[model samples]
Target: MHPRIRLELAKRWSEPHREHHDTDHLAEVVRAVDLLASSGMAFDIDTVNTAAWFHDAVYDVHRADNVERSATLAQRWLGPGEGDRIAQVVMATTDHVAATGDVESAVLCDADLSILGADTERYDRYAHAIRVENLHVPDAEYRRLRSRVLARYQARSELFATAAARELWEDQARENLARELTRLGRPVAV
Candidate 1:
């Protein structure tokens, strides 16, 4: 990665109000992608890494266009071919829905969502961290919105796109989501 791009990404993710979407989260995703690649999963590592670094580069709780803005930022910094690939990968994080046959995008999506399968303590912290990020919202409203978001993921037949990710994370991710939903006073899906 270019030093300038690294610096810019650092600056954006370092925003004081960000709790879960900070540089640490970016590093975690990068590490996850690297691990998957090292295990012989075939994908454009460079593009995946680039996308990981920029995926949450423009996070805003109130903004639905953060993914588009992040994609544009990637294009601006990385230029066409690679940038476009990175942008597509970043966009995949918007809904965590990679197109069929797009392994690279699937890997990127899996990497971004890896935290969902973390241990109970860590997952709890992640949930709290997100609440902190959206601190402006009332508790009840946040719970409702957060429940809806988790429900969307839970409703998916497959939570992780890549086989490796699915094998490793699917069950744990579903368990974690159910736990969270119960905590939020929402009924978990069967």
Candidate 2:
């Protein structure tokens, strides 16, 4: 990423509404991707790094198409081949799932969701910041909706697509989600 572009992304992430999804999250995901790579996952590092920079480049709580918008933003800043590939990986995050053989998508998605496995204090701060970001929703409604989302994530057969993430984050992620679910008055998976 160019210096100017990196600055622009920093600016975007610092937008007033962002709490948890700021540059801190961006840097954390980039670090997680590196961690995964260091664990011996082979994928195009440059493209994945670029995709990480662009993943939440266009975040908007009210918008359902931030990924598409972010992808377009990426194309404007990146070369054709890289932009196209970044768009593909970024879109894969829309459903938060990677295809069977897509190591890149798995890496990117897993890195992005690495927050789920953050240490207890960090995870609590993340949960609180997420709530602050969604203050548009009433408290009761937010709790209900957030519970459903967390439950669905907990119910997934595999929360992290990559073997590295499963080994590094799966247990902690489940425990964190279970803690949050209990707070939300949702059932935790046994």
Candidate 3:
């Protein structure tokens, strides 16, 4: 079921024309969803996986409210009840307050952050890919923008809510955030 939903999401948004919301990103999110599922977190994996696949489907490089757009799309796909919950998880992904959200949302949030714990080379590649994806933005603008985003990411200690997530990923994520912040010239004060 989730696989079919993922296919639907990929069909809608993972075209060659787009940069950020591509098949690779969808795959990564799906992997994270699976990790969360295996971590014993109580979540509707079907809904969360579907939401993860579509969370960035409508992202605009310059627009800030893609979460709302993503949530709307998920809601429409889900219809009442379950759709509402799916929408909430998608919304939680949108740079908002995920730590205080529902249990499912918290799990989803951890899944999303799992990338931060990836191997350094892989994480570096992801950053480079993001830059290429948003190539319309000038280098200086990208640097500042990336710095702000990385800083915000590092500011949170509650990066992953589930116990397994915290135990497995918290340190690595912080390390990644530190490395990224240093590269972006916003290194945390020692």
Residue 38 shift from truth in candidate 2, angstroms: 0.7
What ranges in model 1 sit over 4 Å off? none
Query: Candidate 1 residues 1-190, lDDT tens each?
Result: 8988999899999999899999888888988898788878988898788788899899888888999999999998999887888888899888999999888889999998999988889889999999999998999999999999999999999998888888777889999999999999999889
Which residue pairs clash within candidate 3? Answer: none
lDDT of each: 0.90, 0.90, 0.75
Write out the backbone clash pairs for model 2: none
After TM-score superposition, the amount by which residue 147's alpha carbon in candidate 2 deviates from its true location, in angstroms, is: 1.2
Every candidate's CA RMSD: 1.0, 1.1, 2.3
lDDT of 2 by residue, 3-82 (tens): 99989988998898899989899999999999999998899998888889899999889888999999898887886977
Ranking by TM-score: 1, 2, 3
Give every collision pair in model 1: none
User: How high is each candidate's TM-score?
Assistant: 0.96, 0.96, 0.87
lDDT score, candidate 1, position 113: 93
Candidate 2 structure lDDT: 0.90
Q: Is candidate 1 or candidate 2 better by TM-score?
A: 1
Which 10 consecutive residues of model 2 have the lowest summed lDDT?
A: 75-84
Which candidate leads in TM-score?
1
